[model samples]
Target: EPLPYSAILQPGHTLGMMGGGQLGRMFCHAAQSLGYKVVVLEPTEESPAGRVAEYEVVSAYDDMKGLDTLLSYTQAVTTEFENVPAASLKYLSSQIRISPSAAVVAVVQDRIAEKTFIASQGIPVAPYAEIRTIEDLEKADNTLFPAILKAARLGYDGKGQARVKSVAEAVEAFKSFGEVPCVLEAMLPLKKEVSVVMARGFDGKIALFPIGVNTHINGILSSSVVGVEEIDPTIEKAAQEAAIKIALGLNYFGVMCVEFFILEDNRLVANEIAPRPHNSGHYTMNACLSSQFEQQVRVLAGMPLGSTDLLAPTIMLNILGDSWFAHGGEQAIEPDWASVLALPGVNLHLYGKAEARKGRKMGHINIVNKDPQQLIYYARQVSDILH
Candidate 1:
């Protein structure tokens, strides 16, 4: 598993990215900057990456003609989102090399499967059960009452989860959620949410990014202040070790995100994993020695992984779709645009999207400093403007 410089690709080669959202947009910029060409495989005519990348194929990832075109033009393939269909990845793998493997997609796509695999690996996860039917739900222990129920597939931004007060509430919640199979879990009184973002090189080497302290509004991530607070050295080590284990086990060869819930008791519970660059990691664009997107391109391009150290204490605030709406003719999400621009060490990245719906991530801003209080103050300053 040494660095596969001969077997893997390098800068100046084209990477086919299978998604065209903001993540892909930043990825396109990163790859292009690293001397790698980029081709976006997206169905959206106005995809953000299509606007930024060198070339784009306007077809679904599952389309064979599109896949053929992607493989013919690109040296390797990667994805911006973890939920990209495993079948589509398998098809692409037949024609071109794919990093992170389709099996990683298959596992991370479903909550039940992901938790099961993590638990099997002796990783800590919340007490949970998969419910495919009323009977399955009924089997949930009463001790696990007041649980968080989430759809097994396509759940993001708090879009497909509900909190149930009781077993009776679980039944109604399931019915309201179309009665599909889902994950029901005991709700932990989380002290805070944190995330660890890392990249694994083609040689099976792992690079751990600075941890992010995340804040969510209504179960949807709103802002992330980098680095956790009051963390035991052992807990920090455990989090990194857990990430290395999962990424290596899944044969992942690119950037990945692992979110954790730190309970009041100081135990770290693995909340979920994203086998791609994550929203929380956006702070790295300005604060990390190597941006996650750039590091990802390097990893997939046969280069050694770069440093994961933070350049400064960073504060990142997300501009959700609500920010795009005009309120009294003002951008609702404007994070003190002029004030932020005036502040030193502040950087802005806007995703070129035509339209924004409620709760959709529109863009992000990062502020760097040495003081955590100053970082949080500036973060709140921005969040207040946008929120």
Candidate 2:
């Protein structure tokens, strides 16, 4: 159980964060804006969040000394990424108030458990089979072919996944993945990819932002657009309802993003759930009354949930490190920020990473306008400059 709202919300109270990625960096900004100090626990030195946090505990996720040090600094904690060791979160939860609890993280971090849990809640997920050994792959259903074999853990951004058309291919891929536990999911005809970002409070209140129409390039999220006109009304309502159902089922207590696949038949199939504020929800930073990161802080601090109203039709473009090599050179060249900035309704946010590598998420640009068409127009202009 978490501490009471009054105990956690005292002025100048420090909060602890579990990861130091770009998400943590934005989370630090939100926490600071709310008059709370942040401490980050990350093994890496000079991590994005570490740079912004008031203190950084330099230790591995499961390091007891580091966890102890973090507990000493803050009574409330939250994780920036789901991959953090569940044991570490469990240990921390014993001493401090943690949102989305260790149990939730444990369930969502593994593909097998996550899919099973979602389906058990009466939510629709793509047909999938668990592959723990070679026999499991051989015995998988024939209809599951033309499917994606994904490692059950530590896979993200197109990694640890392969498309297989037969049991032989699946076996090969499974061996290549070091025979790890995996899930074989049937691929569906996806008409569109959409996601809903919602925040649930300790009081069981849920606030969902508008659904984001998403696109992917090289299996990585390329862009997400949120607007009243972008999604069908029926699809939007179903997506929101499914998201709320999953939150309630998990008893989730933080900002979570549920990505869904809208099929050609207009059926909504849940793809996956991110236990933390997600990349797709980054648009909320500039277009909503409260950003997802701020909502995360509110949940962690036991504060009342904030409004999730969208203030404008917005498009968020992910700026990958590939942009730096657009000219094809050994040295990375910066994109023309002047041109991108000159465009109306362009909100540029660059993650302060020291180096640029292809496919790395350097930052994002949020283009907002009253006209939906203009939002799309501005997004293309920004892409032209960045690419």
Candidate 3:
């Protein structure tokens, strides 16, 4: 049952966030904008969200003292990343409200469990086989070769994954990962990738944002373009419905994302689920009537969900740490932000990270315009400027 509004919706009340990355930073901004105070629980001394939050609990995720401190301050809590210890969420849920409960996070954090859950929902997922031991790898069917061997846990941003063409290669990769549990997924025909970002309320109401056509470079999302011209109406609706079905299946609350692989035949296969606001949905900050972060805040506070209507054609470009050294230098050099900002319809957002390392997500740019073509053109210009 949902908590009474008086318990959480009161102005100046505190909210809790687990994980202090860019997503939590944005969630803090949204919560504060709605007259709420946010306290972040992250072990890092300096974090993107910690720097902006009203308070910071600098302790490990499972630290009892830390959780108690956070609980003492906030009536509700939400996680910024899926990898946050599910035990920590479960502990908190015994007291305060936690969105996307520990049970939901537990399922999504492991690739094997996540894939099985999606397939069980009657959703189409890529052909995959679970590999927990050398024997399991040997037993894997030859037809599933030319597959990606992914760690079932603690893998993200293209990490903990390897592409193999044979069972021998898969065995070697499995051994390389300390024989940890993994999933071998068959490679599919080439086509496009897309994602749907939606927010589900405690009342079972859901609001979905527009489908984002995503492009990934080296396993990291490079850009996401959302516009009527970017995808067929039928595919968009199908993706949204599948995402909603998954959210319902999980009995989820707060924001979540469902990534889809659109095959060459135009069939949509569920790739994975993100149990929080996703990077692909960053365009919502500038393009939609209500940003995903704001929706997260509303749901946590027991407030009504906000409108997700797209206000304009938008393109989101990820800014990696590589950009800081794009000028061929051992020392990092700042990109020409002045040139990029000079372009009309360009909105820049930089996460408050202290250092820039190759492959690190430092920030993002959202380009919005009424004309879809112009938006893409602006995105290209911004990409050129950043590179």
Spell out the clash pairs found in candidate 1: 323-333
What local distance difference test score does each model get? 0.84, 0.91, 0.92
- For each of the candidates, the C-alpha root-mean-square deviation to the true structure, in angstroms, is 2.4, 1.3, 1.4
For candidate 1, the per-residue lDDT at 131 reads: 95
The residue ranges of model 2 lying beyond 4 angstroms of the native Cα positions read: 5-7
Cα lDDT tens digits, model 2, 1-387, are: 547645547548998999999999999999999999999999999899999999999999999999999999988999989999999989988877888789999999999999999899888999999999999988999999899999999999999999999999999999999999999999899999999999998877888988888999989999998884557888889899989989988889899999999999999999999999999999999999999999999988888878899899999999999999999887999999999999999999988999999999999999999998888888898998887
Following a full C-alpha superposition, what root-mean-square deviation does model 3 have from the true structure?
1.4
In model 2, what is the error at residue 161, expressed in angstroms?
0.5
Off by over 4 Å in 3: 1-8
Per-residue error (Å), model 3, residue 89: 1.0
* lDDT, residue 87, model 3: 95
Worst lDDT run of 10 residues, candidate 2, spans 2-11
* Model 1 C-alpha lDDT versus the unseen true structure: 0.84
lDDT of 2: 0.91
Can you give the lDDT of residue 227 in candidate 2? 84
